[model samples]
Target: MIEPETVIICLRAAMLGAGAVCFGAGSAALLLAPPQVASVLRAYLQPVLRGAAGVLAVAALVSLAVQTADASEDWSQAISPSALFMFATTTHAGRTSSARALLAVVSALCILLARGNRIALLRLGSLTAGLFLASFAFSGHAAMHDEPTRTLQEANHIAHVLSGTFWTGALVALFCAAIILLRRPSGDQVEGAELMLRRFSPAGVTAVVIVGLTGALNTWLILGRAPLDRGSIYQLLLAAKIAAVAVMLGLALANRFYFLPRATRPAALVASIAIECALGALVIALVAVFGTLEPV
Candidate 1:
């Protein structure tokens, strides 16, 4: 049987990953897409954003309870008001998780109440989603350090997560747009989609670069050495995560260089991007596992 802690970690990762997809996709649409294209994307994305944020809020609360129980090593304490209060009030992870839950709630409400207001979605929704992601920095491995190192680790973690989410989430948006365009073929829509892809290429490249750099820095900071120990579960998971990322990079390169140039073959483009999204999901799962493990 899987441990409750592991289950909660997976739950947190899934919710946070889905939330990132909304955030990155929305932000990319606002920044990279033409007004008409963005409007259409928004029509598809807003519902997802609301749903993911709502789920994230609920998952955060549920995870908080599970974490409290795990921390207290007494399953009954999961529902004990005093234990819950102490955990939420006293622990770094508890405070951060609480903040994340609040941010997720606010994000959901902003999208729900905005009700087609682009400005509010862009401002309030993005602000809350960004904060939700940033909350992870205050918990987990990043928060375990002292003094200036803690600040440095936290900032690096934020950059790492933001860039990673942007990369994976934008791929999700691109895949959705590709599928829709393929279904309802249009010259203008194709042109807009192509333009969006063009705009995303450079940004995606930059985000991936940051993810690599900051990820390496984070690993070094956490393990205090290179991650080469195959004997340890944490190291093995880390290696698997790295391999998945490398495969993603290869797929991205193929999309950028091979499939993208042949714009007429959008089926091929769609296939490649879909694969990237799948791999991105895999990476999130791997991170969820390794993130909960102690490095060797």
Candidate 2:
């Protein structure tokens, strides 16, 4: 049985991962789609983005509180305003938590302010979301390294996360667009979905490449030449994540090369995308488990 602390860590990681996917992917989809399509997608996505940012902010605070409670061995101390404030202001974990909270707040504000045909507002919101996603690197394994190595690892981690989320999240948005197109069959919506898919193909390929490269870098950094022994839960989970990602990549390639050309069949395309999204969720769940295990 997993310890309560491990469960809490997994929950925290899952919330953070979900928030990253929603905000980062929404931003990417908004930027990648054509203006008219973007406007429509934005209407569908803005509420989700705002809600994700709010949840992230609350999750960051709760994570800090949980850690405080664990360290102090007193629930009251954890909830004490003075303790929370001091921790947020003083400690490294607290600082990262505060930064995540601040970023989420800023992202939410940007989302709220972003309305209508203002390209600048959209761009601002997108940039803020990216920044919010980047904040995760500071609090993860990348932060454990030293000096130049730490900077490099963090950069790679940021790239890995942003690219992964962008692909998965954009796929989700596209899936929704496909569903809308199927139900309503509007000419503009159909055209927009096709155009978005075409544009996304190249970007998706690029993002996958980056995710693969950075994932390798992260594994190397974490394992330091250690073999993937079955005794090590982290290594075992890492292997599982890699295998899941491999399958996801295979599905993506199949969708882009085969099913995509037959774009007339909306049902088939949506099914393929839906499967990919499920696999992506599995990868995220594995990552949450990874967060709970210490790397050797």
Candidate 3:
């Protein structure tokens, strides 16, 4: 017997995780252009970025549907094969279910509108990233609660999430893009692949800084104090998240100053990004659980 609250909470957790992936990957794709082009990045880079964003977007919408089903009694009871086949939904459907579903459809349409414009697709993907990032405010412990400075806290929370999403999502997608671009022996393409890694490395470093600073500011507002004073589950999660992110940074630094300058093949780039993705997924899992916990 999954209660509506429990179901909704679970969906919100998955949504936060998936949304982080979307925002991170989409931003990486968008920013890769100017710098990577000069460095002679592989041809398949843009398409892989778009594909990763598309996949992450779909995951987010699926989570939204789960929440919708839980919120709506009609949707909840008959949601198996029959209702889905009939496209039936519940009357108690949440406002966010409707809005997020609409956003998912719109974001999908936006991707189709891009067609084959690598540059446009890259930028458009980043904009869709913005949509999922906003989903955080409408759900979770933050939604519909009363407080002395709720508005200010929500605003700060949004910034914290957006900045972290862009930073984290971009790194995850960049790794995927690397894998797609690096497949097979790249005897001729080695130079371009290496160039892409080198160019994007600095940007990754910068995004880490932004994620940390914005996240710290957001926490100060949300907790009404620094990490030491805040005693909520969310605060504890924040501490863990900071530590995980620190480890991720160490990995990125290793990739940058150690392997990248001389990484001579598409396979090496692909493998390196794969390792990064594994680490990133671990961080996102923490974020998923974090988003579900109470702030106070």
Candidate 4:
């Protein structure tokens, strides 16, 4: 049987991964697509965001409970209101978890309102989602370093995650949009996809660069000249993540320069995008594993 701590770790990772996809896809739709297109896309995407937010809320609660249990060594105390309040107010991890829960609640509410067909609500939802994404940097390894380095690493990690999500989430949104278009094939759908592809190409390139630079910075900060052959689980996971990202970049390049330019079959493009999204999820899962492992 898996230990409760292990379960909490998995929950944290899943929460983060789901939150990234939710926040990234929603923000990308708002930023990259026209209002009409974005609205339509949001109708499909908001439900996903709401579901992810719910998961995040539950995970945060469970994680906190686990931490309290471990710290106090008593399940009954862990579940007590007084204990929960004490943990939330006293510990950094607890505070971060509380913040995450609040953000998830706000994000979910905004997403629901955004679905009400109000422009103001949509914009608010998008901004809230971005904030939700940024919250992840407040905890984890990024928050472990001392003083100046801690601040710098946290900022870099935020940028790295936001940029990575933009790329991955945009791909997912595009894939969903593409599927809708394929089914109907209206002139507007074709034009909208084309426009979004063109707009996102430049942004995607910039995001890739940021992800690379920040990823290297993070690795340096965490590993700090250590050799991977030390057989550390964290290092092994990091290496796997790097390789997965490299493959994603290759696929993105193929889509941009080759398949995209040639107007590859819609089915083919969709397949490629789906594959990229799958790989992106794998990277997120690895990141979750990395967060749980101790770096050396």
Task: Tell me the TM-score of each prediction against the true structure.
Answer: 0.93, 0.89, 0.71, 0.91
| Segments of candidate 2 deviating more than 4 angstroms | 1-4, 112-122
What tens digits encode model 1's per-residue C-alpha lDDT throughout 148-257?
89999999999998888888878877876666566655666777777887788889999999999999999999988777887889888888888989999999999888
Backbone clash count, each prediction separately: 0, 0, 4, 0
Q: Which should have the higher TM-score, number 3 or number 4? A: 4
Per-model CA lDDT versus the true structure:
0.79, 0.73, 0.58, 0.74
Candidate closest to the true structure, highest lDDT: 1
lDDT over C-alpha atoms for residue 248 of model 4: 91
Report the C-alpha lDDT of model 2 over 30-62, residue by residue, as the tens digit: 666776466777677666666665666566657
lDDT of 2 at 206: 91
- RMSD (Cα, Å) of model 3: 5.1
Query: Candidate 4: which stretches are off by over 4 Å?
Result: none
Error of 1 at 106 (Å): 0.9
lDDT of 4 by residue, 39-123 (tens): 6666666677677666756776677787777667777766899998998899987888778777766766666665546656656
Clashing pairs in 3: 24-169, 24-170, 25-169, 25-170
Cα error, candidate 2, residue 218 (Å): 0.7
Which structure is stronger by lDDT: 3 or 4? 4
- Report how far residue 138 has shifted in candidate 3, in Å: 4.3
Give per-residue lDDT, candidate 1, residue 127: 68
